[model samples]
Target: MTTITTRTVEYPADGLTMTGHLALPAGVGRRPAVLVGPEGPGLSDVERRRADALAELGYVALAFDVHGGRYLDDIEEMLARCMPLLADPDRMRGIGHAALDVLCTEPRTDPGRIAAIGYGTGGAIALELGRDGVDLRAIGTVNALTTGRAGEAARIRCPVWAGVGSEDPIMPPAQRDAFTAEMQAAGVDWRLVVYGGALHAFHHPPVDQAVRPGVGHHPEHARRAWRDVVGLLAECLPVTQ
Candidate 1:
């Protein structure tokens, strides 16, 4: 069995006590940390699986709750709930900063070996953290539905990797092209990988709900993305384990 210890973290933000899960790998020394932001499903089971998987790989992974306890049954409601947080740059930055503080303040975390990864709306949060100059070692995002603010990309000092599907209607190839150009122009070390036929929420497996459309699980793609994420983290963050 893999050695993993789970802890509950309370983030005091917006006067709300959001509950989050922190999984730590066993060791006596400080370890590289990854702050994972959950997707629109509102920190579903899959994200906990992701945190456990990362912990099994010998990293201290913290999956933070940005939506508090509010979960939406429909896509429209999820978007509506997340819009204000994303629109208000300060709130978006604050949310990510709070997660960072949790990770950095942890006794098992190596302050210098910190990174972040997010998906969908969480992807926007990851980008926001990078743009806010969080001193992260690396950053990763999946299907960034919302773009960062003006000049935010230029503020990112770490290597950034973005994975998106070519057939994603939410973020078309044209927009991906434009975003890639903007990153290049800003001199940010960035890369964009477009999966040939994958759609939005590609990382999440299909659920029993009948309301979700254009959502399907691609385990192969998910595995590939994990490899890329692990490689990026290892390259950027110090090997503290």
Candidate 2:
């Protein structure tokens, strides 16, 4: 197993003191970095584990915070905060950039070789970072295919990979169509993978906590989707020894 270190970090964003979890592979000069965003609920053990997994692959990883360090167990609360924020691109950019800045500040991070990936609301924030024209190597999002304001052109320069569950009601066909159209119109090198018979948040493991309707976990698709995400990252931001 690779040696890795992790710690909690506090930073400001969206008028809140956002807390982030950073993971680094042991014994490293500057390395490619990845910014991970958790689901709408907030940063949890899952996101941190993703960061650790990235560290194991020899990339400096930062799992960013949302909702002021509070995990929204209540679906209503999650919607209340996420709905409005999703409508506001500028706010999402602010949140994404704040974490990006923190990730860049790490000595082990090769700032120019960074990728962003997220789940749920965090996925939307990742997409916003791409649309906001951040110089990311790649953008990978799962279960957050929500479209931006109409007529606003997306300025994503890097390749983008987005995965969605076919049965995800929140990101149904219409939303996927819109997202694809936007990406195509922007002339981005983008691919969308749809997992059959999976629901929203299929990438996430089953939780005992309250889950909104139409949300379920699929172990098989989850694994495959992760492989695709890693492939995208390896293609765009290869980790060097």
Candidate 3:
């Protein structure tokens, strides 16, 4: 196994002191960087492990925080904060840009080559960054099929890939259609994969805390989604040896 390094990084975003996880690949020389966004519940060990996995693949990865350093185990509290934030594009962009700035400033990151991959609310932020005209190599989102303001998606300069569970009530067929319609209207390169029989947040591992209705983990689909995102990165942002 390739040796990788990990650290905790503190940065300010959305008026909160965010603590993120940064993972570096072995023997890196300004490697391509990736931004990993957490779900609405906030950053967890799940996201940190993903950053480490990406680092092992020779990419510098940072798993950014959403609720300062706290993880919201209560579903109601998570929605209370995420609902309003999701409705505001500017706020999402601010958070994304803050994390991007930290990633760019890292000595191991190649600023010119970066991709944003996020889950849930974090996924929405990644899409917001694309809509805000960030020069990203690619954008990958899971279970956050949000549509931007009218005609704003045209600002997205990179290809986008999204994954969602077919049975996700939060992102039902109607919502997915709306999101895809917006992407199509903007002429953005986008793809959506619906995992059959999976529920909302299907990619997440089983949690000990009580989850919202229609939120469940599908271990098989979760692995598939990870491979799909990694495949998206390999195709759009190849790492040079």
Clash count for candidate 1 is: 0
The CA lDDT of each predicted structure is 0.79, 0.90, 0.96
TM agreement with the true structure for every prediction: 0.93, 0.97, 0.99
**Poorly placed runs, candidate 3 (over 4 Å):** none
Candidate 1 per-residue C-alpha lDDT over 21-45 given as tens digits, one digit per residue, 9 for 90 to 100: 8999877678889988888667766
What does the lDDT read for residue 124 in candidate 2?
92
What's the true lDDT of residue 40 in model 2?
86
lDDT of 2 by residue, 1-241 (tens): 9999999999999999999999999886999999999998899898899999999999999999988888887888888998898889999989999999999999999988999999988999998888777899999999988677654436788998999999999899999999999888878898999999999999898555665689998999999998998899999999887
Weakest 10 consecutive residues of candidate 2 by summed lDDT: 146-155
Badly placed stretches (over 4 Å) of model 1 are none
Residue 67 CA displacement from its true place in model 3, Å: 0.5
**In model 3, which residue pairs have backbone atoms overlapping below 3 Å?**
none
Which candidate tops TM-score?
3
Cand. 1 TM to true fold: 0.93
Clashes of each: 0, 0, 0
Tell me how candidate 3 scores on lDDT: 0.96
